[model samples]
Target: MKQWLRFLGPLAILAIAAFLLRDKMPFLAEGYQQVLDANNVGLVLALIVTIGSMFAMAEVMRLLLMAGGTKVSLWKTAELTFVANAWSSTFPGGAAISTVYQYQTMRKWDVSVIVSSWFIVVSGVLSTLWLVGLGIVSILFLGASFSIWPLLGSATVMLGIAVLVYLATTHPKATSRIICSEVRTFNRLMRRDPERWIPAIRKHVRQLHAVHLPRRRFALIAALSLANWMLEILGLWLCIWAVTGALPGLERVGENPSFLGVILAFVTAKIVGTAQVTPAGLGPVEAAMTASLVAVGMTASSAFGAVFVYRILAFALMTILGWIIYLISVARGGMKAGEQS
Candidate 1:
């Protein structure tokens, strides 16, 4: 009964989300037909790119885990990433849901709390920083003047995190002491036994600090992270082209949207959609994406057409894929494979 209840919350949220976004159903329907009628070759290429993006993300997790000295097979990493993305994208506050799932799942591979926490935090920070970097490049490519402050701020945060991680490595004992102290304080406030938690916290932190990857490995992960975003951007571009028949440098009658414009629109929608107020940022993402496309010179109708198709191909289709894996994994065992072990 408890296991079943865990599934109900996301189902309810998805039902409500679908109901709320009924206004876009018409566009979604049209977009569905548009994709169906697109050139066979172009459609196939877009699907391939979209599929690659999923694997690229899975690789990010694998690399992060490897860096932390947790040796897991790539297949397992991909499975976990698929489930995490599916879980997180399915409900409100899914990020937290996904984080908890990932932590629990990694524990099966003997990943300690400190290492798992570092993997989550570092992967998230790197991915966000990578997105901001892409956004900056997209802004520049659009040949429009925009404030650089946000990019600067994000870069600063990324650098700060790197420095802190390095400092923790250099002084693991001190770092563990500080973190364990905070955990004990919080535990005390919650009327828990600080004595019971502090040792475990310190041990995990010290272990986490000891497993640092080389600079070369770090660079490779960074490259993989950026490639993941680029592949996703390519998926967006292909969707727009499929809808409007507009390539990067090609001019058409009444619809000549540049590839850079679509790229910019993609970045903007992502930034706006991270809130996850609705399941997978349903209404807000489509609205913001359509508006940004229009701002970048596509007609409003064409903009909506493009965004509708993109979301269908990217979010909706991926969600379906994730759920299929989710069901299979759950039936094979449970949320964490180690539980079966």
Candidate 2:
């Protein structure tokens, strides 16, 4: 079961993606029919944003991986991260595959799992905090009309990260002890391999000064992450515009308050639903998305179309790209060699 995490992880993410999509396409198609203006410029711009966001996201992941000492190239790191990301959205368990893959990628580059895992966790957590923190700010400052719930919601997310990071960094040994003591089977194995995780976590806590977060570079990554989310959200907004043809009230983006909610729902569903072993978030995430859209004040049909477009843009395309990259690595006949990378 533990070993299967590699393969099953991707499957789980895909499952959620699929679950959320149930019976949504038809309704979305109908919505598209209703609003057929197809402003070539808006759509083209949206596409450009989508591609830029993907690459920007790649940089964020690369930094995290490199922090672990994997020393992977930007392009190579980006490819794996993008593929794994698409996989993660579908299968709940897919994160494990992505995790193991990250370790493998770093091992190829002569990095330790200890460094890789800690780096991945740190960067992933920090990046998320930044995104959620920004969302909260936008809601509070720019999104004045949005419900306080959304604003509060964003603040809470960052707060959660702050607490976790403090606990993990301040007390790696105690925390590691807890996991060792409480997790039973899992704890024993991890403890057995000190180099794999424990030491790095302890070091992360003790030597905080060494992990210098360069201000200019850090700011760029944070900005890129923010842009990634913002552009992705805008893409969904444009899809809605394409379907409705009527410009949703200017306030809709800020006033409706759900621009964040929909993104939240999609990411949440993608993350949580990946637990399933399905091919992609085929069922769980789709269902979650629809429910989430309704909560944010969108008509069911409109929400359906918006989600449909998002899935195609974020998932379908990503899967193809991921597979292509995976295949290329295989064809290069360097799977083992690359794993060291």
Candidate 3:
């Protein structure tokens, strides 16, 4: 049943994408061609920046784990991280895939599951905050408009900050509360005899609370996380620069609420071909983005060239790189195969 769902999910997503794009596809096709034609060798430079900065994300993870007293080397940890990354960007439920795979990989390196979860959770929370910032920046500079979803983005950041404080200061107790609230029912359903699950959970929670991170390490983690965020945004900025000679300011970029609205609509497009799933966010991103542009008092097609090129660099190109890294890991037996565990 699980296997069946996995297969169906992508198919379902693609089918929906096709239905959405049945109308303005020619324009989408034209946009894609325009993007490709506008590309220059400089994109490879952006790719290099993206790839290098992306790898730096691994360093951030390593520092988090180290703070918890797990002594894994940075380079060794990054190798396994590569595979974890590959799965997440390319697969549905990829987040879970990366989580479980990273835990298993770390175990091979003699890292405990508790420590592994800490590293994973920390990296994710920090990374998410960064993503929110990037999203905001993207909007600010976007030649399109996005919905003024109240303080939705701000709320998300604040909640994440609260969670981080909880994790850093009063972790075990807070984490347990969150888990119980979120997953208590799932726990009951998974077993013949439902267990409170607190004692076991508390064990890890206590470990988290007890773990001491030095001030230097904490600062390092914060810095690296910030760097990771800036690098990717810089990559996006560079991509736009490539297509258009000048940069669009924050107000200009944040012009697309429609783009924002339709993102979740076709987000699952990766599995479906662009025609079906619109992997490039082809028609879906464009239409939504165009609507967003109009919302911000911008003109559609006036910046069509910039929008298309930006998507190519930000989404399509990075995903392609992710796939390449995945394939390399698979062929090498395993990322950790030859290395000492």
The TM-score that candidate 2 achieves is 0.64
What C-alpha lDDT, on a 0 to 100 scale, does residue 149 get in candidate 2? Answer: 68
TM-score, every prediction: 0.82, 0.64, 0.63
lDDT of each: 0.74, 0.58, 0.55
Name the candidate that leads on TM-score.
1
Model 2: how far residue 177 lies from native, Å: 13
Candidate 3 lDDT by residue in tens digits, 1-341:
45335434554664476447746755444444445665475466666766666667877867666666666666666666655655554554466666888788777766666777767766766665554554555455543344535325654765676467546454567677777665667766776334567577666666776456677876787678778656654554455455544344533345322333222212222213223232233455545545443444433443454555555555556665555666676797655622224
> Which sections of candidate 2 miss by over 4 Å?
1-29, 32-44, 65-71, 89-92, 134-211, 246-250, 253-280, 294-297, 334-341
Tens-place lDDT per residue, model 2, 27-112, is: 54454544354555556665666766777777776665444334455676677666666556434566676677766766666555
lDDT of 2: 0.58
Ranking by TM-score: 1, 2, 3
Off by over 4 Å in 3: 1-33, 39-41, 133-203, 249-317, 337-341
The better-scoring model by lDDT among 1 and 3 is 1
* TM-score of candidate 1 relative to the true fold: 0.82
